[model samples]
Target: MTNDKKRWLILILLAFISALLLAITSTAISIYLYGNKTYTAKAEAAIVLGAAVWGEEPSPVFRERINHAINLYQNQQINKIIFTGGVGEPNEAAEAIIGKNYALARQVKLNDILTETESRTTYQNLKNARSVADNSKLNKFLIVSDPLHMKRAVLMARNLDMDAYPSPTPTTRYSSLRSQIEFLIRETFFYFVYLVFQI
Candidate 1:
């Protein structure tokens, strides 16, 4: 190849290698962070980040999150529960509202169920949850979600200045190594993007 073409090829090769290395490194770091179980004592509320709702019911993944929050409430670790999720469909109930109804049916009182039905994404969930918590003086929060999701969720919580504890569900559908790895990779990419561009 010509000298100019040879140099261009070398640079492109190096760039590709660098990108690959970064992806591997970030994925490893994300897996580590995803398993981290951060918590605090005497929290005022347990914030259940919203997930998909099947029809008018919380989806299995979302139910797992709500169950954890309910466990916290039962143990008195948190005084109240704040459910965050907006409606995904035009006529379906908001995720938070659906979760609240579920909790109430499970014997959690309506008075202690706080709903933030204006957020549909994780970032929005925490932002809207923080607003609801602040209005009710439930400042400290135990954030509940799938284990692999806590890393980014906690990062966003910190950015929003919310006193959030990363309390991931004890078990989730992403239990297999393959599923876990997939989630880790996706989270790493998004986390990196969020860090670099604040998107």
Candidate 2:
């Protein structure tokens, strides 16, 4: 109403906007830095998160994630591998089943392979994986994915009350700055959305 009051209101609004921007920027930086990191924490199972499966085969990204999990399994860092993804189209193999088969072919023991074949998104993946983990009396999980996807994937896992650790693939498909930043920004956005709006 008054000039001084209007000036104070404008100042407060600017400060609020500035704070939000700073928070968002800080989170983005954290996500970017953390995504590039690899964890050494051992867990009961490595959750190989799903990516595109080309018909009956895994896409490059999915293969990298599965290979990383395979290495963990071979190194005895994890006792089991839980692959998560469901059928995306008619006649398409569910990603979890395809990933399990790949690991089996690569010599991962048959008894150590598990699948959650109903998840279509990251949240659903972890959500359903948690159920499988619960049924098996397993609590700790190593979340395997592309380096750029580790943060949110771990967030979802921990949010589901699992002892979750990050195990991002060392060789990621996002090999360029443009691809890296694009994924970083995208994951950061989803991370904030999940933090603010979901458990």
What's the lDDT of the predicted structure labeled candidate 1?
0.86
Colliding residue pairs in candidate 2: none
Model 2, span 101-124: residue lDDT tens: 999999999989889999999999
**Per-residue lDDT of model 1, residues 9-119, tens digit only:** 999999999998988796768656666775747688988989889997888888988988888889889889999999898889999999999999899988898989999
Worst 10 residues of 1 by lDDT: 31-40
TM-score of each: 0.89, 0.92
Q: Evaluated with TM-score, which candidate comes out highest?
A: 2
lDDT of each: 0.86, 0.90
The segments of candidate 1 whose C-alpha lies over 4 angstroms from its true place after superposition are: 1-12
